[model samples]
Target: MPRVFLSFRKVDSRWMRDRVYQGLIGRFGAGEVFKSGESIPAGADFAEILRRQAAECELMLVLIGPAWLEARGDDGMRLIDRADDWVRVEIETALKAGNRVVPVLLGDATMLPEASALPHEIAHLARLQFLRVPETHLAEELERLCAAVADLMPDIGHGSASPTAPAAPAAEPTVTMTAQVSGGGSAYQAAGDQTIRLA
Candidate 1:
């Protein structure tokens, strides 16, 4: 199973991000699902861990809420504008590794900004297709997201919730025919009896 990475700005989309993380964790298991804060040890190096996870994971779900783009850093600049921002680093790492990045829209987040509105490193994010999950439809959306993940990454089993493969058509039964013939010169034989056994 490919590791699934959850990426989002901490202040702007924490609630929705946590919800999405919980949903994915239930389907992909805690070990396979990677999220900051939840999976990291208190003393771990956040940057190093993020780089490792982003480089290794096969898919990254970027949670973009209404305030995501405008979320600011400690220096009062937009977080996405800062080249060293962890969120930017995570996205850049994943993109460099050629991992799939899924933009998840929340609370009416319509679409990402155009390349001109973003820094060069992550500008490509603007054109990627995204998934939206309105708060009211979170559960339904999560189910759909899980289905998409299953389709994209076939080896990840969702425990008891895994999609069932279509049952193969039953094999045709085998038949044996026997003909009874009288000891006569005529070559004709009585109608044969047949027996069929289901496999």
Candidate 2:
């Protein structure tokens, strides 16, 4: 099972979700991160998969784009307010299971609504501090988010925390020398991992 669950509303933040998902996959490996539709099996039950992943994951990132709170269903009710909304179920399950649920504010998403504005099952989402992924500084902010997730779930392997290969040794510095020649000054340059003493 994946270590991290990405809870998102497709219409509201699919692009942002995909971007974050790729960054997380890069850090945590593709098998360690879960995004509902993309990670689920073709013939498997969607609701069961979502609930199981949400409940079992170590971290749940709720992608809150600008429209997340207010996006309405066909009946004009806020999607978050609906009991059957997948996003709602995902978050609620994670929260109920005592998993670490983080609200990630996607591009231009300012903040979460008040607790009272949300359904009781997921209302605590409003009280949680959020990580912002602004479009302007996605890479930098994404690194911060990835680091934070790794810190919170250090037992899980992360690229930054556990590199695939040991880092290469630093290159030796180049050395240049100028010596007086019979006709004119001469210059010489050498580069290698070596120590030289001029006599």
Candidate 3:
């Protein structure tokens, strides 16, 4: 199974992130997908964890929401402002590490100005697959997302038994018997025409 790292603006799309995480787990099994919210350990360095996970993952999913382009952190800094915003850093690291990056549009949001102007190295994401989820149909949207995840990381669906396998053949009885009355004794006999008919 391929490991996937999810990057999103925490304050802007926390709920959607969680939903995506659940959907991924349902499709790929819980251990195959990793999210910062669930995988980060207490007292761990946040930036280092993000970088390490990005490097190790086989794919990275960027959740783009309405406020993603403008959401500010505790330091009042937009991710596009600092080259090292955890989200931006994770995406860049994943790209440099030769991992696939899929940008998922959560709402009708556009990329931030700085992000929009990023070089091909950072903007290579524009050519990758993008999925848009309408807010009204989140569950359905999540199913679509899971399908895409399974498609990109085929191992998620591989090696698993299909839900629609053919049914097994019915068994047949191997023996039949008949009661026979003889002149001096009663006996059980096989139900075959070859038996002697003594009257």
Candidate closer to the true structure by lDDT (higher is better), 2 or 3:
2
Residue lDDT tens for model 1, 1-199 = 3388888887776777787878876776777778888878899998888899999998898888878788886779888888788888999999999999988887654577677887899988888988887777789888887778878888775454455569999966555644455667454343344363323
Per-model TM against the reference: 0.75, 0.78, 0.70
lDDT of 3 by residue, 117-179 (tens): 554447777667677766777888888888877777776634442233578977655553344
What is the Cα-based lDDT of residue 174 in candidate 2?
Answer: 63
lDDT of each: 0.79, 0.83, 0.72
Task: Please give, for residues 33-100, the per-residue lDDT of candidate 2 as tens digits.
Answer: 88877798899998788888999998899988888889997888888887888888988899999999
* Clashing residue pair totals per candidate (backbone < 3 A): 0, 0, 0
Scored by TM-score, the top model is 2
Runs of candidate 2 exceeding 4 Å displacement: 158-163, 166-199
Model 1 CA lDDT for position 23: 84
Evaluated at residue 47, the lDDT of candidate 2 is: 79
Off by over 4 Å in 1: 158-199
Q: Which TM-score value belongs to model 3?
A: 0.70
